[model samples]
Every structure is written in structure tokens, then in C-alpha cells.
Target: METVTIETSDGMPVAGLRYTPQGRARAVVVLAAAMGVRQDFYAAFAAFLAEQGIAVLSFDYRGVGRSVPVAFRRSLRGFQADLFDWAERDYNAALLAAKAWQPDVPLLIVGHSLGGQLPGLLPDNHLVDGILTIATGSGYWRENAPQLKRFVWFMWYFAVPVYTRLFGYFPGKKVRKVGDLPKGVIYQWSRWCRNPHYVSDARGRPIRAGFEKIRVPFLSISFTDDEMMSRTNIDRLHDCYRNARMERRYIRPSDVQAARIGHFGFFRPQFRESLWRDALTWIEQRTADRNQAQSAA
Candidate 1:
């Protein structure tokens, strides 16, 4: 894995890591991370994919992890970034970088949670060949998993507002919620979660139009044991991609011979032999199918 810097269209230098296979790559994947989750969290998974002959690029959005500006390093107070920037700029940059890295190979995205939802926001999403979303869903609190509904309500109704106002940002690390986030991000995310339409309801954005524009192969993987994303939430988000050839799969722990595979457990190394192999097969199959279609055409 090589540490790299990706410059967003606005000239912000976001930090990232690129994992290249020793052999020629069959595909290049941009591993978009979940909300408030650092790119490093996917390091092990990315490396595993790399070892399987897939080139992977993982990056941090501007306000999180290595991309955090110097001024906001100590505190996110006055940091200026929202979910839109993360998608339009940071994620877009990663996609472009992956394409440039292996222009001849298939380009794919493996998005986790928020990472999965933002692909629609990219202006150049037409360049993508496929997307695989894990533990991704609409953030509407009302549609969340039963166990997390009330807690999500508390966080949205009370904690987010009070904490963001008091600290000039959502001190999630201190509060032990999502993780530290910029003021704009928490505020915008909270508003979306409060609304049933989620990002589509965001003030002036053409989010739904972007989703409709995506025509690539798309797949969503959700776990029965995921404590955060319910089947409804997952379906609601993917429903936005009306034009995509989309498929949804739900897995039970017993299917994978595991005790529990929650929202975050899919990427854990323990399930590597079982869960990871399945993901790799899907990616390879998608790439092969696309290649076959193109060759015939």
C-alpha cells in the first residue's frame, strides 16, 4: 500500500492510500468509507482485495482522518465542510484517481454506509462500471433498525443540536456517537435523518436526479443482524437508483457460520475466508460479465 494525496477539484489535498496487486489488476475499486469513519478503517479489507488482484484506493473525506485541515486538527470548531463536499469533491477525487491508476481495468466502488449513498452525487459517475454497497441505507431515523430507533431519536432530537451548538461541531468522539464531525456535516446529516426523503429533501440539491442517472450494475449487501440499518432503510436508499440494474442481498450470521455480522462486522478479518471471498467473487463476476458484453458489442 502506498500513501498518496488526491487533490479535489477545489484544490484541497485529501489523503489516501492505494493498494496495488503484485499481478496485473482485473479491476480497480474505490472503497468509500462510512460517515465519520476514517479511510484507514478499511485498510485491512482493501489489502485483502489487493491480494486478490484488485487495485484498491481508500481515502479520507476532507474533515476526517488525514485530510483534516491543520486549523481543525485540535478541534473541529470553525471547520467548514458538509456531506455535499464529501461526495462532490472528496469521493469524486477518489473515483478519478482510481480510474487514472488503472484506466484499462473495470472501475468499481465498494461503499459502506454513507459511502454507498454518495456515489449518486458524483458528476462523473458515468465512468463507474459497478457499485457494491455494504451496510448502506437511508439515514432517516424513523426507518432505522428497531433497536436503534429510540437512540437515533435521542441523538437527532437532543444530542446533535445541543452538542454541535455547544462545541461548534458534533463532538462525536467525546459523545461516543458516530465520531467527531464538522459542524456542517452533523447539521446537514441530522436534517436528512429527520426527513423521510433523506438527502433528496436537502434544500436545493438535485440528489434524486443524480441517482436516476446511474445506469451501472449495483448491488447492496445487508446483514440480518445489522443493528443500525433495517431492510426498509436499505431498500429506501437503493430505491433512489431507479435506472440501475440493482440487486439486494441479505445475509444471516448462520449462513456465514458466524455468531453475528452486524453493520461493521462484514469487513472484520474474522469473516475474511467466508464473507470476503463472496465479495471478491461478486466483483470478479461483475467485471467478467461487463467485459464479455463489451467484447460482444
Candidate 2:
């Protein structure tokens, strides 16, 4: 595993992990994990891809994991307060950096959860050969969002407005080190529930249109019981991609025979092999078409 610190087009520093196979590569995958995820969570996937002759560039987002930026004061309002632009540009820069570092390699984007929605948002800009969105979604995207976030936002819409007026900004519930999330991310996310295309900047471009422009072949893979993304998000993604070919599977945790393939299980210690088997198999079947085309050409 090789490590490097690279800057995004927006200049936010991102830490990248490159796992190269022993021999020459089959392809390169630019991986994006769920929001708040670190690169280590994707170690198993990277290692598995590398073992299979595929190289990976898995990196930390702008403010997640090892790529913590010098956060500005939280008082900035509206667009200035949103980190979505920073995060999106960081993803693009990671892909470009991967190709720049390995010019001859074929590039495939593999995004999980929020990362899943990214390639569709950016579409087939020449930097990519294809895209794979795993357990990704459009907006209000808490897979558990309906029961969890709808309630929280109902509470926050009332509770937070008062608190923000008092505290200058509402201090969000902290899970891990993402302390005091700014209201802007939440506010924008709320708007996304109605309009996923609500982007304040070009870097934070909307995917609904780009989703239609995805000319590169795409593979949208998901588990039925993903904790953060519902099956509907998967359908929405597939429907929007004009030239996409999708393979959908549900991993049942209940059946003794069914793998314990929940959203988190895909990264957990116990279910690693099962998760990789599903993912690698999907990649193999889809990319084989491209491989054959290249060979024949």
C-alpha cells in the first residue's frame, strides 16, 4: 500500500492510498466511500481489487479522516458555509490525480453512498472510462433517513432555529470527531429532499442532468438492506442514467444461507469476503464487455 497527499482542484488537501498489484494492472478504480468514512474502511476492497490485477486510489474526502482541512469559523452563512463543493471537487481531483500518476491506466470510479452519487453528478468527463455507484443515492439520502432524519429535521427545524438564534449556530449532535456540523450542510440537504439539483456552485453541480448525460457504461450496485440508501435510490439512479446497465441484488441477513450483507457488513471484519465476492463479481461481469471491445478493436 502506497500513500500520498494530493490537493483537489479546490486546493483542499486529500490523502490517497494506492494499492498496487504485484504485476502490471488490469485497471484503476477511483473509490469514494460514504460520508464521514476513512480510507481504512475501504482497505479490504482495495486489497481485493489489487489482488485481482486492479489498482485502486482510495482517498479521504476534504474534511474526513487524514485530510482534515483548517476549518474556518462556523459563522459563515448560506453558500460559504456549505462544504459540498469542497467535497465534490476533492473527488474529481482524486480521479484526475490517479490518472496523472498512472497515465496509461483505464479509470473507473467506484463510489459508495454519497460517493455513489458523485460520478453521475460529474458524468463522463474524459477523465473516466466508466462508473460504479455502490449503495448510492440522490438526496435527503439518509437510507435510515425516512424514520431517522425526517424525525430529526422535524425536530431541528423547530429546535435548531431557536438554538441558532441563541448560539449563533445550532451545535449538531456529534458522532465521532465531526463535531458541531454547520447548519448549511443540513439546510442544503433539506432542500435536496425537494430538489436534488440545488447546488450553489458549479463544483457542487447537480447530477439529475448529468445523470442523464452518463454516456460511459455504468454499473449501479446495491444491497437491499443498506442502512443509508433505500432501493428507491438505486432505481432512481438506474432510471436517470441513459446508457447504464444495472445488476441489482439483495443480500438477506435473515436466511441462514443468505450472507449477512448489510450496509456496514460490506466493510466489517466478519463479512469482508462475502462482500468482496459480490462486488468483484459485479465488476468482472460488467467490465468484461469493455475488455472484449478493447481486445477486438
Candidate 3:
């Protein structure tokens, strides 16, 4: 594992970690993180993939994690970051970095939550061979878990706006929601969660092109007990990628013999034996299939 810096198009430095296998790697996998989550959160998982002979690149979006500039970290209230910047700038930079690091390898993505959605927004998304999304779903309140509907509503209508205004940002750490988020990030996310189409309307107009260009093979995995993302939500989000050759998997805790494998539990070390190994196998098989197809052609 090596810490690396990727420079965004907008002249910001994004922090990342690159995991390399001992010998020749089968393919390269980029691990994009969830909203308000740091890059390091995916470290162990990246290491595991490296052990499986796949090179992995895990990065933090600008203004978060090790990428946060020292000046901004001292006074986070002054930071200006949003979901649009994450999609256009941060993910773009990470993709460029990955290409530069492994010029000859096929690129795949393992996106969690918001990370999954951002790739569709990038113009060069077709450069990727495949995408696997875990616990990724539309944040539309109507599609959220029924029991958490009221709480989700409150978060959008009350907590987000009020907290962002008072603190010059959303102090998510205080509420144990999603750590501290930039004002723009939380506000934009709240707006999207409230809408049915979810970011389909950008700057008051419909974005007609980006997502449709993502024709890569895709896989989505959703847990039965994930508190934030219901099956409806997962389907809604996956539908956004209109051109993907996609497959969806719904895994129950009992399937893995666990009492509960919630939204975040899949990355825990305990799951290394089951879900992690299975995921590696799936990635390998997909890569092999793609190689065979290309050779035959």
C-alpha cells in the first residue's frame, strides 16, 4: 500500500492509496468510497484484493480525508465542496491517476453508495470494463426503508438546512450521521434525496447525456438489512444507468450465516472469509470472460 496524490482538474490534490500485488496483476480495480466516508475505510478491502492479484486504487474525494488541505482542515466551515464537484472533479482525477499508474491494465470499479452514481456522470466512463456497486442506492426519501422514512424526512427538511446554516457546514459528527460534511455537499444531497429523479435535474435543467453513455457491464449487491437502502432504492439507482449490462444480487444475512450484515458490515474483517472471497472470484471471472471475448473477436 502506498499513499499517492492525484491532482484534480480544478487544481486540488486528492489523496489516495495504491495497492500492488507481488507478481503480474490480473486487472486494476478502483475502489470509490461512500458519501462522507474516507478513503482509508476501504484499506483492508483493497489489501485483500491485492492479495488476490488485483491492483487496487482507493481514493478520497477532494476536501475529505488526507486530501483535505491543511488550511481547510483547520477551519472546515470555509470549505466549499459539493456532489457535483465530487463527480466531475474528484472521480475524474482518480480515474486519470489510475490510468497513469497502470497504463496497460483493464480498469474496473467497485463503488459504494454515492461512488457508484458518480461514475455515470463522467464522460469517460466507457473506459472502464466493469463496475460493481455494493450498498448503492437512490437516496430518494420515498425509496428509503419505511421505518426510517420519517427520520430521513427530518434529515432533509430540518437537520441539514438548519445545521448547515448555523455551522457554515453540516456538523454530521455531532449527530453521528456521516461525519462532518461541507455545506454544499449536504445541501445538494438533501435536494437530490427529496427528488424522485435524483440529480437527473442539475442546475434546474435535466442532464440528458452523461449516464446514458455508461455501457459497461455492471453488478449491484444490496443487503437485506441495510438501513438506508431498500430494494426499491437499489433498483431506482441502478435504473439511472440506462445502458449498463447490469445484474443485481440481494444477499440476506442468513445466506452468509451472520446475524446481521448491514450496509457497512460487508467491509469488516469478519466477512473476509465469505463475501470478500466471493467478490474477488466474481471479479476474476468477469475479467477472464472479457479477455476471452476480446481474443475471440
Candidate 4:
């Protein structure tokens, strides 16, 4: 594993880690993290993929983890980032960096939660051959898991607006919600969560057009017990990719012999034997398919 710096188009430095296999890699995966989740949270999974002959690049978006600038490390009150910046700038830069790093292999994205939702905003998403989304869904509050609906409603209607106004950012760490986030990000996300159309409803944004342009192979995995995303949420989000060749898998905990694999359990090291292996199989198969198609062409 090697530490890398990816400079966004706007000149912000994003911190990332590259995990390379000892032998030639069959494919390269850009491991995009969920909202407010650090890139390190996916380190073990990235390393595991490397051991299986797949190279992986994982990074933190601006205002999160290592990418947080020193001026805003103490507080994000003055930070000027929103979800759009994370998708259009940070994630796009990482994808470009991964392509430059491993030009010959198929490039895929392994997006978790919010990570999966933003690819549609990327102008260069066509550079990716495939996408594997884990625990991703539309953040429409009404479509969230039944158990979290009430709390989500409160967060969207009250807490987000009140807190963002008070602190000029969302103090998510104090509230134990997602995590500390810039005011723009939290406010924009709250708006989307309240809307059935999610990001596509963002005023003046051509978000849906971007999704419609995606024609790559897309695989989405969601757990039956995901506490934040319901079946409708998952379906609604993937439905945006109307032009993509999409495959959806909903895993029951019993199928994997686990008590419960909630919104975040899929990335736990405990799933390495079963769920992880399944993911590896899908990635490898996609890589092989892409290679065969390219050769025939």
C-alpha cells in the first residue's frame, strides 16, 4: 500500500491509498467511501482485494478524513464544500488518477452508500467499465428503513436546519449522526432526503442527465436488514441509471449465516469468507467479460 495525493481540478489535494497486488492485477477498483466515512474504513477491504490480485485505490473526499485542509481541521464552519464538489471534483479526480495508474486493466468503482449515488454526477464516469454498489440507496426519508423513518424525519425537518444555522456546519459528531459535515453538504443532503427524487431534484442541476448517460455494467448489493435504506430506496436509486446494464442483489443475513448485516456490516472483516468472496467473484467475472469483449472488438 502506498499513500498518494490526487489533485482535484480546483487544486485541492485529496489524500488516498493505493493497494497493488504482488503480481499483475486483473482489474483496478476505485473504492469510493460513504458520506462522512473515512477512506481508512475501507483499508482492510482494499488490502484484501490486493491480495486477490486486484489493485484498489481508496480516498477521502474534501472535508472528510485526511483530505480536510489544515485551515478547517479544527472546524468546518468556513469550509465551502457540498456534495456536488465531492462528486464532480474529488471522486472524478480519483477515477482519473486510477486510470492513469493502471491504464491497461479494466477500471471499476466499488461505491458504498453515498459513494454509489454520486457517480452519475461525474462527467468522466464513462471511463469506468463496471460499478459495484454496496448498501447504496436513495436518501428519500419516506423510503428509508421503517425503523429509522421517524428519526430521519426529525433530522431533516428540525435538527439539520437548526444546527446548520447555529454552527455554519452540521455538528454531526456531537449529534452522533453521520459525522461532521460542511453546512452546504448537510443542507443539500437534507433537501434531497426530503424529496422522493433525491439528487435529481436539485434545482438547476442536470443530475438525471448524467445518470442517463451511464451505459456500463452496474451491480448493486443491499442487505435485507439495512437500517437506513429500504427496498424502495434501493430500487429508486438504481432506477435513475435507466441506461445502464444493472443487476441488483438483496442479501438476507440468514443466507450468509450472520445474525444481521445491517447498513455497514458488509465491509466488516467478518464477511471476508462469504460476502467478500461473492464480491470478488463478481468483480473478476466483470473484468474477464470486459477483456474478452475488448479483444473481440
Worst 10 contiguous positions by lDDT, candidate 1: 198-207
Q: What is the TM-score of each candidate against the true structure?
A: 0.97, 0.78, 0.96, 0.98
lDDT (C-alpha) at residue 167 in model 2: 51
lDDT of 1 by residue, 63-111 (tens): 8999998888999999889988999999999999999999999999999
Give the C-alpha lDDT of model 1.
Answer: 0.92
Listed per candidate, the RMSD to the true structure in angstroms reads 1.3, 4.3, 1.4, 1.2
Write the residue-wise lDDT of candidate 2 on 155-189 in tens digits: 33565466545554444432222234345554455
Q: In terms of TM-score, which candidate is stronger, 3 or 4? A: 4
- The window of 10 residues in a row where model 2 has the poorest summed lDDT is 173-182
lDDT of 3 by residue, 1-297 (tens): 999888888888888899999898888888999998998898899999999899999998876788778887854697988887888888877887887777777789999988887887875677788899999998889889777785888899889988889989888888888878888888888888888877755554445378778887888988999988989999988887888888899999999999998878889988999999888887987889778988899
Ranking by lDDT: 4, 1, 3, 2
- Each prediction's whole-model lDDT (CA): 0.92, 0.63, 0.85, 0.93
Q: What order do candidates take by TM-score, descending?
A: 4, 1, 3, 2
Cα deviation in Å at residue 87, candidate 2?
5.4
lDDT of 1 at 120: 87
Q: Which 10-residue window in model 4 sums to the lowest lDDT?
A: 199-208
Q: Which candidate wins on lDDT?
A: 4
- Distance from true position, residue 41, model 1, in Å? 1.1
